[model samples]
Target: MTAEKRIPLHILREITNGFSEHSRIGRGGYGDVYKGVYSGREIAVKLLHVDTVLGHDDRQYINEVGNLLKVKHPNIVQLLGYCYEIQNELIEHNGANRFTRHVYRVLCFEYLQGGSLDKHLREESFAPDWSTRYKIIKGICEGLNFLHSCEPPIFHLDLKPANILLDSSMAPRLADFGLSRLFGGSHTHVTNRVVGTEAYMPPEFIKDAYISHKNDVFSLGLVMIEIIKGSSGYSGYIETDEVGQFTQKVLGNWKNRIKATSEYPLEESHQVQICIDTAMRCVEPDRNNRPNIAEVLDILSKTETHIPKRQMADVFPCPTIGLKSESNMLEIMVAELNNNEHIHCNLMPTDNSNRTVQQLADRETSSDVEQVIIGRTKEKQKILSILSESITEEMVNLPIYGIGGIGKTTLAQLVFNDPKFQDYTRVWVYVSQEFNLNKIGNSIVTQLTDKISNIPTK
Candidate 1:
């Protein structure tokens, strides 16, 4: 994260084509969001409407920025820059021309390519795999947990699918903090100025104007349900008196999907069950009965205990033949062990054992092969960031795993050939399902010997 800088409004207008309608990405109660480029990187710009009266929107902007500045978490959206500029223009008021003061309030965030989770949940045809959904649910929980862990605890009063943005890799980041509040002693507050999506609001927040960490918990439960059972899940839950039966039905729906798609159907099925159970517990009408975010995450962590300890997968791209042939053979991942990153990454283990590769990134690789590789720059940069941060003296093996035909090999190749690795003796050995640590070690030794043998005797 970088320090929040004040950006000029003119620069934003230019980047967004004078805030054209086509550039607008979303609208909210306080303002409009637009896609814009800043400092050569894609960014999201929020243009907040100024209300000359009670100045409530101003408080929203301040509240959002203030909380955002205090928090830093991977699952939480990052604030890159902001703009607060005052402009005066001549306007006819009371049948006389006068200069009126107007203030521009803008916020900039790192652009997310996958858009909001609301869109995904609302789309009947769009179903993200169970793994992606589980990851998102867990991410939201962790972020909520982080907010709750803050000193005095920050409550995200507005928590919903619409406020959760997905990145290129489908990771969820919490956004929209206008309604968040910080409560110190007793960890509770009461205010009648209730605002936010009604459906996600808990009984206490909506009925009594009561607020607590559990307020966000209740909302989180609704969000997790929607992520698991579609946008209609919450409605169905509220309608059901037999919560146990409703949960089973939700789990059953996911089980069928897992049967069709997931390799670890049992593990995914277990996750789906936990999510349903957690959601049921989180949305309890009595705030006292609702599980806190930490407790929710505690339960989510148990999901890992049910999953297999290891499921290593190998991926490499082969020459594309035809649609049928390529689908069958282009990606051959052998897995008996499983890791989340291994699920959908295109990375490989390192060959260097004697000296760790300190920097595994950020040099160009424009070979003829890479010229054909499209839509992998973000993946490449992400790997480079991970590599660049590794301890200079230690080895960090990054295994790339992803669904079939997702260009895992292309990303691996991109990172491997980057000029940053020029100093290292490179070795490329394809490992398959029959993963033999001894055999892999021998192969690396043989490659190192061959490279040494080829070196000039001088």
Candidate 2:
């Protein structure tokens, strides 16, 4: 669609009217996914639950669509068209009725009948044979390879089974491009605000560490392990202390088996073992050590020659006792602090040299109560420059936290715009109210690394 031409609201109304219950295929954080017959062809329509031009979510929604439209690839899901409409409807709850305006932002996509990989694995009756699993894994690797091989590698920040869709013949396709990012220059890394599923996320990303294509590889490794085990492999590790240890142990065992023989038993197929090994390599603690998408594809191709059965090996368990204790301790401290409401102290120190600390604290408090007042534009720019310089010297995760209107985002924007930031090839992303973790992750991946956006099916 051209920028000058807009989809009429009447046409959008007609489309929604045609979306019967029978056409509803799935539902997600965005809204409902419907399989619609338009112009005699089937298409998957993702109807957004919110408006793209209203509230704080508008910027994020519009940005996502604009980014998706710019990147075109065979593996990436194509955005055929979009529909926007608003309708006033009455809702009754507990015998009370109210009128509200509902806004819809619907996106149309190519239909894939095989469904999501997550749905298949979660269902007991839909177990895929070892050969089918291998093929799916290979397809994903090829898609990723294509993305990485782009002029500037793309990073798929979120790599998970649920995002992968299958066509009628079980061919895997990458479906979502909402979170993909395109790497534009020589600087290899960019620090992003923490996003994505915690279980599948790399430790660095979780800590707001410098992110790169390696983060995507780490996530892909987690997905690969889950596919091999025929389970949501990392779910059990959630809230556990020994999650890293467990992952290392399982991956090590698989790698040892793969290294020992070429003609392994069907029950212990070398392909499965190698796949696990590659995944482990991707999840290496050091991002520098993880393989690139092209290397991952090569490895997967080499291992795809054989099929392996599922083995009931001893599963490694994450240590949760220590973690639970820490959580309980934090909760107790918070409760105690909250209960002592009467206790107050003058944070300002008696020493004259320490007055700046008190002044800064007072300013912060005032900023929270009202918007930060910048009397001089030049002074504001100067402060931003100083902060950015300080941040650049350290390779650590430092959050730019402050009150909403106290210029946290404004300061970040200045840093992003600085000429120095260009050296690192920065990607400036804003995760406003409409943030979707999966889409954010995908954007980072496609933009930063060489990975195709094609999500394979169930």
Candidate 3:
């Protein structure tokens, strides 16, 4: 462990603005954390509650500083410095001369702007994308692996979303090691007292006070499941079947958003299923059956990873009832196309086999757009006839060439929504001023998998 600096208490007070409530960021068992600016660098200063910390013989403070100094990894939070000092004040008690002493213990850590993972997990309107969430899970695994594979394995008794902080770029960094215990060449330890969150505790740890690396595996498993499902806590209250069945059911519940965002049926993806399999193995009832940190990392790092093809249609899926009008769809389509090369909309079909309309909100209706179109019957019939002619031949390129604001998109939408074309496979490609055949082909493949796009609005 490197030599940590000893910071003065007066400097900590000055930077934290006298530990004002405005500067406070979080509160834990130790004390309140304040955001401080030291030497032009933002830092998190945890001013330990002297009364509370002193009771435990300053064990929590000592453990945190010790662990932080010992471990240094990209995924683990770094310790900047610490302050352990004392202040003496002369006083008169009972009309006699006396002196009082105040001890100060403060730990400084790198400040993360994005706050904790728990904040993002609880957001209903906008959750992290699958790619970001996957990176976080992977990072957590790497951090745990590093700790468990040390010269003397360290057991982080408290590993949860609240303790995981996100940096400015949304990369996760594991923090809060007050509950961590280092084992000396021993794989497991037995203690009468359990000190960790109940939801993340393994059965053996809670029942037998047994502590090992497997305990961390169990916690990691729960965290992975919650992160994927966007649940705030474990779903232990829910009656669960076998691990496979439980995973299938969870994925089935999120199949709609998964399809629209991922552009691939997650249930059918081998890479996704492997994650489920690994999570199940980690959360096994028997610790002996569970995979260790190395095995878990190996399973998660499989090279047979599937990368979804970017599609225009998937980027801007079918126009939704949530949109205010045809103009709204046009605005969103244009904005998404110009702003981003890839987009994930919540409005899409539920599953691969079901193309029926799935409403985005409680007020959304399937016939919302149908009512907005006043007269397109003749236009629809003309497009249908042209499509019929092209279907009969081996291959044909039939384009409805027209000038701007000529109702080309409206005519196409009407024909596509017609009941006759419901059974036939359809692909919607919206080429702008610059046309790219490769992108269009990918869009077609995505549409074949039941992801449909809309006509471009010029």
Every candidate's lDDT:
0.72, 0.58, 0.68
Residue-level error in angstroms, candidate 3, position 282: 2.5
Summarize candidate 3's per-residue lDDT along 1-458 as a digit string, tens digits.
24437678899999999999999998876578899998899999988776522445366557667776778998888888888777776778899987777668888889988899988889885353555666778889999999998767878878889889998767788887767877775678898765888888888988898999899998888888878777686645233456657778766655655677664455324455666677777778789999998888887676223342121111111222342453454455445444434333222322233354332221233334455554444545666676664564133444555545444555556665666665554445666678654445435434443344454543
lDDT of 3 at 252: 64
* Candidate of highest TM-score: 1
Per-residue CA lDDT of candidate 2, range 273-317, in tens?
577778778878778889988898887665533322222122222
**Highest lDDT among the candidates is held by which one?**
1
Error of 2 at 437 (Å): 55
Cα TM-score of candidate 3: 0.60
C-alpha RMSD of each candidate structure in angstroms: 14.3, 27.4, 16.0
Query: Please, what are the lDDT tens digits per residue for candidate 1 over residues 181-233?
Result: 77788999988686778888888777788888888988888888788877643
Off by over 4 Å in 2: 1-9, 18-23, 51-63, 70-74, 84-104, 125-128, 186-194, 236-268, 304-458
Ranking by lDDT: 1, 3, 2
Error of 1 at 384 (Å): 30
Q: What is the lDDT of candidate 2?
A: 0.58
Candidate 1 regions with alpha-carbon error over 4 angstroms: 1-4, 54-60, 236-240, 309-311, 315-458
For candidate 1, what is the lDDT? 0.72
